[model samples]
Each structure stands twice: as C-alpha cells, then as structure tokens.
Target chain A: MPIPLIQLAGVSKQYGDVRAVDDVTLELEPGEFFALLGPSGCGKTSLMRLVAGFETPDAGRVLIDGRDMQGVPPYRRPVNMMFQSYALFPHMSVERNIAFGLVQQGMAKGYIATRVAEMLRLVKLEGYGARRPEQLSGGQKQRVALARALAPRPKLLLLDEPLAALDRKLREETQFELMQVQRDLGIAFMLVTHDQDEAMAMAQRIALMRSGRIEQIGDARAIYERPASLFAAEFVGEINLFEGEVVQSGEGKFAIVQGGGRIALADDTPLPGPVRIAVRPERMVMSHLRAGSYAEFAGVIADMVWLGDLTVWRVRLSDGRLIRISRSNADAANAAFSRGDQVFVGFEAQSARMLLS
Target chain B: MSLVKKTRGVGDGGLAANLGRRLVLIVPYAWLILFFAIPFLIVVKISISVQRDGRPPYEPVFELADGFIGAWESVQKFSMESYAAIYADRIYGDAYISSVWIAALATLCTLLIGYPLALAMARAPRRWRSLLIVLAVAPFWTSFLIRIYAWIVILKDEGLLNHALISTGLISEPIHIYATQGAVLIGIVYSYLPFMILPLYNALEKQDTALVEAALDLGATPFAAFRQITWPLSMRGVIAGCLLVFIPAVGEYVIPDLLGSDEVLMIGRSLWDEFSTARNWPGAAAVATVLLVLLLVPIVAYQRSHLQTHGAAR
Candidate 1:
C-alpha cells in the first residue's frame, strides 16, 4: 500500500520505574480515524504525546509519512493536539487563538486571518472570533479548541479526551461533529479516551491499552466480538466468562471446555489447557426453558434492570455462576420476565469466544 | 409557626445584619480617616505653616472664637514658601528622579532573579513544592534589619565573598561593595525578592500546563511558547510583584542609610536631612506630601488594573 501516514515500531517510554508506553507498535493510514481506548493510567495519553513529539521513545522509532521522527521536538513535528482542558489562550480572542499556529509558521497576515475565519466557520462558531475563551461556554470552548488545532493543518491531529468535558447530551452531539470534521478535513485523528462507547462510536480502529501495553488492536466490532484475552473481553463491554480447562478438541479448530460443567466452543485454538469461554451479554438468548440442540444452561433470574431501550437479566446458574443476558425492549408491552424466575440462557457455538491467555 | 412570625423573625435578623454590615463598613473608613487621612491633613497643614523656634517646630495657629472662620484664617496663614523652596532647589528634583530610577532598577533586578526562581519552584515536584515555599519565605521570618546587617558583612572589604575570591586566586585586592549605590540596590533586590517570587509562584503554579503544551503542539518553539503563553498569563503577578517592590523601595530608609553612599541621594535620605540635619520641618513635610502624591498614581493604577483583571478572570 502507499506508505502509512504514521508508524510506530517498538515504541516505549518509561517514567522512573513505570513504563508509560511499553513496546507499543501501530500504524495509521492517511485520514484514518483511530482511537487509543483504556482506563486511567493506561498510557494511551502517553502514546498520544509520543506521536505529538512531546515524548521521546526509549526503545523504538516513530515515523510520519515514512520519515523517521527520532529526536524531533514538538514544534518541529507535523502534529497538533486538542488538549483535554481545551487550553485556549485566555488572553487572546477566539480568532487570535486559532490563528496562533499560522502566525508561528510565519504565514501572511491576510492568509492567517482568512484561515482563522474558515476554521471558525468549520467549527460552527462564526462571529465568535472576538470573544475570549472565558466568555464561551464549555461546548463553545471545545469547538474553539478543535478549530485552533485544525488551523495549522498538520499531518496528524491528537485529541486527549476531547468530548469528556461536555455533558452526555453535548458529548454525543460533539462526537458526530468531530467525526464530520475529521472526514471533511481528511486529517488522521488519534483520539485518547477512557469511554468505551465513545471509542466504539467514533474510531474505525481502536487499540485497547492496559498498563502501557495494547491488549488488542482491531476494528471496534472485531475487538468486541473476539477479544484477545479476558481483560480485553471484559474491558470493552459486559462479558459472562466461564473459566475452564480444555477436555476435548476436533478438526484442530473447536475445543470443549470443562469447568464445573462442559462448554463447547468453535473458532478456537486447538491446544488450550486453561481458557475462558467468553460471550457478550447481548449474544446470549434467555428463555423459560432449555432450547433443543443449542448449548444451553439453566439458571434463575436473580436480578432485572430496565434500561429504557434494553432490559438486562442477571441469571444465576445451578453451579452459582452469574451471567448477564440483554434483550431488546421491543415487546415491553408484553413483559414476561422478572426477578426470581426460572430462566435458561444459551449462546451459539460461534459466539463462545475462547480467550486463551 | 405562622407566616407572620417567620416574616417578623426574618425582619428582625435583617435589621441586625444591616446594623452589623454598617458597623463593619465604618471601621475601615474610620481607621483610614484617623491614621491616614488625618495624618496626611496634618502634614499638609504643617507643610504650609511657618517654622518657629517653638516646641512643635512650626507656627501653631488656632482660634476657637471664630470657629469655621478660624479654619479659614488658618488657611490664609498658609504660604507656598516650602513648595517654592522645593521648586527652586535642584536637590529635591534630583532626589525625586534618582529615587524613582533606583526603585525601578531594584524592581527590574528582582523580576530578573525572581521569575526563573518562581518558575522552577512551580515546576518542581509536588512533594517539593511545600518545602520550596517554606524556603522562599524563610527570609521573612528573620528581622529585616538583621538581614540588611548580614549583607553588610558579606559586602565589606574583608568580607567572606572577597576573602573567598582572593583565596581562590580570582582577585588580588578586595572590592569595596558596601556603602555604595550598587550595595543599596543589592540590599533592596535581595530584601524584596520574596515579594516578587511569591506572587510569581502563585500565578505560575495556578496556570494550566496544558496551555504551554498546546502552544508547543501548535509549532511554537519552547521560548516562543513561554513568551506567547506563560509570560502574558503571568502578567498580573508581574504587576503585583513590581508594585510591591517598587512602591516601598522608593521611600525605603534603612537599606539606603545602612548600605548606600552619599552619592545615592534618594528622596528618603533628602527627607531625613531636611527634617533632622537642616531642622526644616516645613521642607520635610512638603517633600513627604509630594512623595505621597507621586506614590498615589501607581497605587491607584494598581488597584484599577487589579480590579479589571479580577473581573476579566471571572
């Protein structure tokens, strides 16, 4: 393929004893929307800083458009970042804040002014150029940050929790706005966020980080459907995991797991002494009785939670294993299940993603 | 309880609170009138009075029979003699100009030394910040006069600094640093450094570090980032620190008397000469009034700008 727009090979950064980024290796295509998703202190922000040239890797090379970026300072790098705090210059007007990067680049005054106006228009903050950051609301500040970071037209744009400061309602709206901007501007975005749903909604590809290492790297759907490990399986969404040992295997693909009970799995490793049979809550089907031919486990509905569009049923097995089952609320008018009711939970063989690690 | 009773209780509390508020507001005004406004009025009265060989050193004109008419008579007795002397004499003019220049230089020196120190303390690790603040403020705990005396020992001809330099072969002869304008400047800058640093540290510490990082991310060099982001943001602190150092340094007596040479003819020294050596109370009071008037300009400017910045921050 035409050389990736950004590349990292065995990149690592250490803070005293803690490895903030441990051997992280990834690539992004031109105009790709990527995300680094993890909990706090997972080094996703550290990795973003590495790409922005604010950090120097201890182990590996970072490349932009196939050029090695070793020893490059932040100012020399072709990257921009939207800070989590939306660190707009409080002393400068919104237009001046956006034009700062262009001014630094020694751009013509007329060109800088036009670009600033265009950026303001792009972020839908027209006529807000003269207003200071302190005068703007939180959502307005976020837009100004976005417009300012985009004003420089760098090869890459890094966003550190860009939508986190906004409320849920505004966050959702800005998420789509950010996506539209990314698509229209055609600049690669590497967003760092702790919110899983945000990552799943925005990023085409996401790398889930844990303690400075990426546990899994794939499209959001693929990562969710086939998590590489138990951590990955549980981190992205709710997963009912059954810990077991491999007792049987056939065709070098499927394996049968024996824990307190047996669980058959398809599309799994042939050799697996100990593993966990993972299934997403939404993937499991719940009924009053065990279905024929499908892998089924009988349990009682221990708890129920009505979540407006979906209802989650907490099923406790005879072996004292708790599993969650999610169902759509399309038939909310005809509610059939409640707490302390007998239920049978089942999932297809293909859905039992066997996490080996 | 009945609504009428609740309303009555609130009314009673409101009256008491209004009385308390009025009392609180009157205290400062009363204090200012007694200590500052009244003393300044007395100085102005003395500044225009005639000097006599009496106890108070100036003619005390009072007539109770005339009442308000007596106050008008006292005003008529007032003369522009002392003010005319100040205008005709070049010494007072030179003293004023020199005082301003010296105070300005000391303020500049303090900023130069204090900004980096403040920046470093601000950027220091969290565990070190409290200790750094304590260290910066440690000088204030000792007596200010004792601190100036300590500087004398350091700057004397056979002082520790000269001895060290001579022993290290850096210089053969001792340098005369004490009782010089440079010595006075050094004393002022050293004494007032904490004033500059504390404000700077508070401002820099409270700044959002992400602003600087964002500047760097926008392709500005490190120095450029500091100039564009850090400096402008910390300007309020700079103003506060400069005012703190400059105002007091203008009328400073101890540092100048103890460390400065006769060549250093600051207004404080001039006022001391006019009052004690020359025994000209009217001349001294006139000089003091002029100095107060000059100081008021910056004090007012500082208050106005401070209010404006606080408003903008909100």
Candidate 2:
C-alpha cells in the first residue's frame, strides 16, 4: 500500500494536570476527508494542533508522508491550519493575505498575482482583492481565510471549527463549498468540530473522541449503527436503550428480559448476565395494531413534536419507561397518533444491537 | 408643559443634556483662555515691544491708564527690532539647529532602546506584566531634579561608572563623560524612556497573537512574521512615543544646563542667557515664540497624518 499522507502513532500531550491528548494512533490515506469529532475539551483541537506542529507530542511520534516530524517548526512543516478565529492580517488587503504564503515560498510576483486571482475565484470572491479584512463580512472573511490557507498547496490541510462563526444557512453553504474545494484540489483534509452533524456531513471517516481518547473511528454509518460503547451510541444520535438480562439461549438466537418486557436477538453467540440493546429513534415503529412477527410493547403516547420533515413521539411503556420514536412525514397515517393515543412500539431484531457495557 | 414637550423632538436630549454637553465643551475652552491663551498673547505683546530701562525692562505695548486712543497709539508703535536681532545673529541660528539635532538624536536613541524592551514586556507572561509596568514607572517615584542629580554622581569623571570600569580593567583612566553632549543625551533618554515604552506596550499588548501563528503556519519564519505583521501594526504607538520624547527634549533646559558643556549652545540655554544675563526681555520673548512655532510644525503634520489614517480605516 502507498504511504499514508498523515500518520500519528501513539501520540500524547499533557498540559499541567490535564492530559489534553491521550495515546492516539491514526492514519489517513492520501486525498481522504477525515474529522476529529468530540465535545468541548475532548482534545480534538489539541490533536489537530499536534499534527500542525504547533504543539509537540509529549510521547510517541508524528509522521507525514513517511517522514518523521520531530523538532520541526510550523513554518517548515508541509501542513497548514485555518485557525478558528480566521486570523487574517488586519493590515493587509485580501490579495496580500492570499499571496502571503506564496510570497514566503519565494514565488514570482507575476505568478503569485495569477495564483491569488485563481484562489479568489475558487472561493467565489473574485472582485474583493483590495479590501482589508475588517471591511469584509463574517462569511467573506471566512472565505478569505480558506483561500489563504489553500494558496500554499500543502500536502495536508487542517481546519479548526472553521464554520463556527457563520450562521446556519451560510454554514451549510460553506460546508458544501469546502468539500468541493477539497475534492477538486485532491488534498487531504482533517477537520476538527464539536458539531456531530457537520462531521457526519463532510468527513468520509470520523474519529469520535471522549476524555482525550478516541472512543470509535469509522465511517458515519458504522459509528451510528454499530457504536462500540454507550458513550459512542449516545453521542452520535438519539437512541432508545433497553436494559435487560439473558433469560434464554438457542441455536443462532437468544432472548433478554427486562422488567415486564422481553427482547430476542438473532446472534448465535449468546451473551451472559445483564446486557442492553440500543436502537435508533427512527428504527422503532409505532402502530395501533401490534404485528405478530415482531416483539412489541404496549405504550401510550406521552408527548409528541412534529418536525417539518419528521415527527418524534415519546411513548410511555407499561413498565413506566419512556422511549422515543420518530417517523418521516412521507406517510399521512403517521400523524394520526397524538398525545394519549395507545399504540404498540415494535422493532425488528436486525435493527437493534446488543451493548455489553 | 404640553407645548414644551411638543417643541422637544424625539432625537433631542432635552435642556439638561444640552446644558451638560455645552458645559463639557466650555470648561476646557475657559481654562485655555484664562491660563494659556491670555499668557501667550501677553508674551506676544512683550515680544514686539522696545527694551528700555524700567521696572518691567520692556516698553508696554498696551496702556489702559491712557485710555483707548493712547493704547491704540502704543500698539502702532510696536517695534519688530527684537525679531530682526534674532534673525541677524548666527548664535541664535546655531543654537536652534543644535537643539533640534540633539533632540532628534535622543528620540532615535530612545526608540532603538525602547522597542525591544516593550516587545519583551508584551511577550512576557501575563502574571508578571503588572510588575514589569510598575518597575518601568518606578523611576518617577523620585523627584525629577533628584534623579538628574543621581545621574551626575554616576557619570562624573571619578564617579561610580568610571570606578567600576577601572576595577574591571576596561579602562585605565577616568573618561570625561560629564559636562558633554553625550551626558545630556544620556539624561534625556533615561528621563523619557518610559514615555516611549508605555504607549508601545499599550499597543503591543492589545495585538492578537493568533495572527503571528497564522503567519508562521503559512510558511513565514518568526522574523518575517514580525516584519510583515507586528511592526506595521504597532506604528501608531511608535509615532506617539517618538513625539512624546522629541517634543520635550527639544525645549529641555535643566538637563542641558546641568550636564552639557558650555560649547554646546542649545536654544534653551540661549533663551536663559537673553532673559537673565543679557536682561533682554523682548529678545527672550521673540526666541520663545519662534521655538513654539518650530515645534508646531511636527505636531500639526502628525495630527493631519493621524486623521488621514483613521479616516482610511473607517
């Protein structure tokens, strides 16, 4: 296999009493779009900083393109970072800011001008060359920042909460434009964001982190459908967890009983002792008549909210447990169930996954 | 009450705020007229008078005791002889040139020494910054004359500086540092260093360090980043500091009198001699007026340039 564009091996960093980045080993294929997804203070930004050479790992190594990057300053590194604050030079015009990195590389003035114009066109800001950063709007400033970071054509690019400053509509538009730019240039990108939706929408692969450790690393579907731990399960999306114990085991099938309800799985390997099953809110079906083919529970609609595209209902089960179920607005009959309506909540065996812890 | 309310529009702040705003503007103008403008006009009047053997030593340009017509006649008799005397003398020209040269040199020295010191203080850890500022201003706690006296003790031929140099074997004999132009320069720089540093520190401390990091991440070295970003951004402070040092140094009297040799004829020393030793009051007033006009050139230029930059920024 070809060498990975970026490789982090057992990297760790400590700040005073806090281990900002724990032992993390990761690799990204060339031209890959990856994300470090976590909440605030979860070390995602720190991990990006380590890769950018702003902070050296207290232990282990950072390798880029098969070369060890130790004792190298940020200026010599073959990577660039778009800071959260944009950090555009306030005194320089937009053309100067975009031409800064190329000038540092000692590119010719004529070529640098053409390159700056090309970058302005790429970011859809063609006629704003002479304006200072303070004169630009928030979204325009963000585009200028992106253009500046991409002007040098580094092997890898790092974005730290790049869209946190924009409004929702602008953020969505920028997200699509950013992905397009990354794809067009064929450069590897590593985005750091606390917004899970942004991470899922942009990154091809995501490394979900918690308490300075990578909880899971996979594509969005795997992380959402087959979460490794309870933290991973709850962090990605909304889910209904049923705590139970193993009551029966058979060939390629097993059953779990929780209070007045029972759940059966199709797995051949039987789990012992207490276990939990996690199912997404959209996976659970609600109907007036219970289907004989699925294991079901009797519940009453406790509360419901109607989102434009989807409707979510909180159902109170016979055991006094509240489980959330969501359905798309595609079906007209789905809106029939309102508060206090008696319904049967059922899930197919394949849709639920057993959690060990 | 209804008519008054109708007359007062929504945008207006009513009578109280208008009075308050007027007071804010009037107080400083009143102070200037009483303390500054009146005295300055009196000096101008004296600068145009004729020298005579009298209690005031100069013919009064205005005499209210002789009534309006008499005062008008005296005003018509105001002479331009003192100004002509200053223009004809080479000593006054040499003194003005040397004073300007010395002040310019001292301002340059302060800037060269103050820039790095201010940058270091700005880069220092946040907890130690207050202490550093306190230390920078600590010299002001002592009396100004006493501080100059202390410099004399250290810079004299057999002073502490020469003694330490001799003990370290750097020099075999005491050097003539006291009573020279170099001593005057040293005194000016030492006295005005805080003026240079305080404004620079204020400007540098408010800068966003993330810009420097962004420059480095874009492939610029630390020095290049400073040249491209930090220095240009702190120019306002540099100008303020230079003006603060240069203006005062040009008209300084006590330091030059105490530290400079007799050969270095500064305008401040010349003014002192004309007023006291030569007892030429009109000549002294003419010299002071010229000095004020000379200093006004830079201050007005700076103000116009400052307004232009601010206008562009807006």
Q: Share of real interface contacts recovered by each model?
A: 0.93, 0.82
Task: Spell out the clash pairs found in candidate 2.
Answer: none
What are the per-residue Cα lDDT tens digits for candidate 2 across B189-210? 9999999999999889989989
Q: Looking at model 2, give its docking quality level.
A: medium
lDDT of 2 by residue, A35-135 (tens): 99999999999999999888999998999998999999999999999999999999899999999999999999999999999999999999999999999
State the lDDT of candidate 1 residue by residue for A140-238, as single tens digits: 999999999999899889999999989999999999999999999999999999999999999999999999999999999999998898889889989
- iRMSD for each candidate structure, in the order shown: 1.0, 0.6
Q: For each candidate, what is the lDDT? A: 0.90, 0.91
TM-score of 2: 0.93
Question: What DockQ score does model 2 reach against the true complex?
Answer: 0.80
- Model 1 clashing residue pairs (backbone): none
Worst 10 residues of 1 chain A by lDDT: A252-261
How do all models score by TM-score?
0.94, 0.93
